[model samples]
Target: MLVQNSLSEVLRAREELFTRTIWTDPTSQLQNRVKGSELSRYFLLTESERIGIEQTIRLLVSTTPYYLSLSDPTDPNCPIRRMIVPTAEEAVFSLEESSDPLDEERLSPVRGLTHMYPNRVLLFSNHSCSVYCRHCMRGRKVSSSGERMEKADLETAFDYIRNHHEVEDVVVSGGDPLNLADARLEWILHELNQIPHVRICRLGTRNPVTLPFRITDELCKIIERYNDDNLSIFCHTQFNHPKECTKEAKDAILRLLKVGVSVGNQAVLLKGINDDEEIMLTLHKKLLEMRVRAYYLYDPELIPGSRGFRTPLARGIEIVEYMRGKIGGMGIPHFVNDLPGGGGKITIGANWYLGYYPKTRQHAFRSAVTKKIHFSFEPVGSDKESYYPVLSEADWEKFQAE
Candidate 1:
């Protein structure tokens, strides 16, 4: 287990890695908020990567909604409290946990591109970020898959995109496309720009958060080379803890922004990590300041050994409620979960009753009209059962029985 010493130790550690000037007014206020440790300055993603951002700091927060249960705030037994601060048990649970939880190979078409969705395609390559995450959903493919996306695969994917006129958008992602050499990435971008039907090109990478150095001046220039009215880059950067956002990471993010890339962050709402309301609020605030739009704040999946990382729906809802009116609408991210059985990603957002409010239904019945209510509303709750709709329960049961 990692020891929790006084905030002084954290500050001292920060002083060692980063110069004192980095810890200016705004940073010092944040540091004072999380009194125990100087988490942001010290927790580097991987040894080779630059030290993390010096501004992020974790705090004692909760996931319980203000409308729901807020009592007994300190125990992990509570759904909202389970992962506020991860224990050593949670971090090093076991190695048997499969890394590639999605098993995306089942959805691959020809090469590199995965035509999982009808209108969209995923370009999977061997590029990776600065560090390998222990709880990475694609853990299975990163190190051992030995599957480098060859030129043939890129051509096949591009060909598929061209043939399928319905495919109006393409998301270029891999372990981390930024990890690919600048020349190779430029080649891919150049090819995609030629496809007239392809209206948008989105690049999914985490270099801005993991290995900020990858976003060099040359890389920025290549990305800018393809940036026009139609082509825009989509970054799926993850930041589980506030401390992970370092000055170097910030610099990397600015480079992409300078080049006109549409930057967005996709953070997984881990149990003991940044599951607290204060921590989440601060992180979101920082993202907006840095010009990064906060995307999905996901609930960790129950992949083989990922139980320790999973948080209940209520915990996630609690955090949302806390930040709803408190912060700007743009700062809030929709909570989501990628369901099992290769179902597409779905957002778990605050409940907006599409059919009818209970009172509305009751009043309608009183008026003597028995009519079917047909309304489609998006859900933002904790129920896993409703996460996916690709197959109905009956259909799944039928398939299983067969």
Candidate 2:
């Protein structure tokens, strides 16, 4: 087990961290992580720098000692440092920016429940993450004390799911589901398990990377209990850079896998962080090596105070296209844009469509791998049923059983 301490309790936990293989909170265990380093004689701090840090502190402020240690103090553009370190760049908001870029409120049936797609829904469980991520999509709500889910909200979510028969999946997300005490999380999962309509329960959390100490043996038992055949539970974690795959992080992930809860990663494509092709490739490869599947490579949202992280959509497309033949299928995730204005997740990849003409009765496509042009004439007098690979109900059941 690992232990983290507040500033005052820092010395008490030092011996445990030093002597044992267990990791201690590198930045002290407090969720509100600010102040770059010790304010000792190592380097005289300036008033201007302190003032700048204070302004950014007005927004969400948090990071683990473990996550911060991955950064290079010398380089201003260090990807990990850019992620956790607060700066005045976050204070600036563009005119086109929005608080809810996805406009999730538009799709919400209730306050905390968002039913965007017919078959899947999102349960915004709570909003107190152990560490506040700089490039979080839900920047408007995350880390704020008001983001925590209330009893009424949970009841409303259950009611919404009960009423809507079309919904088969419920994505439990918030600041981080794992941030909740094991008992509270178990109660939520137990209630969710009672709903027969909910086939899958996916928990999206960043604790495995930012705060591995939370992955206790008790929590592992809770996951294993909820992950039965009828109602399945899966965990979705975020790790932007390869450096985030630290020993403790990997151990946390392995614990989940050991309990039969499959894990997957969803990485945001940030400009100075992981926007480059090589960085993304390495991140993807590392995720698979830990036995976690690469699920989604998300495009940064145009939210207020997040212009610093946004990357060109074209750059994301190129990275996905380039990795098509290079890595194995499990290593590749959908390079997706959670399109603005409540428009769903749209995959952004190399466009294969070149051109099509009705009069000439021809269609052209540019192959992504070979970069070669291919043309074909419009089909005439073809049987629609036989042309496509259509599976019957019995065949589908057989295939699934196999």
Q: What total of clashing residue pairs does each candidate reach? A: 15, 2
How many clashing residue pairs, candidate 2?
A: 2
Instruction: Sum up the clashes in candidate 1.
Output: 15
RMSD of each candidate?
Answer: 12.5, 9.1
lDDT tens readout by residue for model 2, 1-402 = 112234344433333333342345432454434334331111122343243345552247566555555665445577776776555556677898888888898898898888888899998888877777777778777877777798788888898898888889999998788877777899889888888888899999998888886787888999899889768999999999988988888889999999999999998888888888888888888888888898998988887667778877898888988777778989988999888898899877776664544444455566666766666666875434244333345544443354
lDDT of each: 0.58, 0.74
- Whole-model alpha-carbon lDDT for candidate 1: 0.58
lDDT of 1 by residue, 1-402 (tens): 124444465446545533432332222222232221222232222211111111111111111111012112223343322222223333333445444445467777775667778888888766443344445566545544466778887887888888998887788777777777788899988877777777778887765664565677888999898887656655667765566566766888898889888788888887666779998999888888778888888877654445556678888877876787667888888888776656878877553322223211211111112222233333444254333334345533443354
C-alpha TM-scores of all predictions:
0.66, 0.81
List clashing residue pairs in candidate 2.
26-65, 27-65
- lDDT score of residue 98 within candidate 1: 43
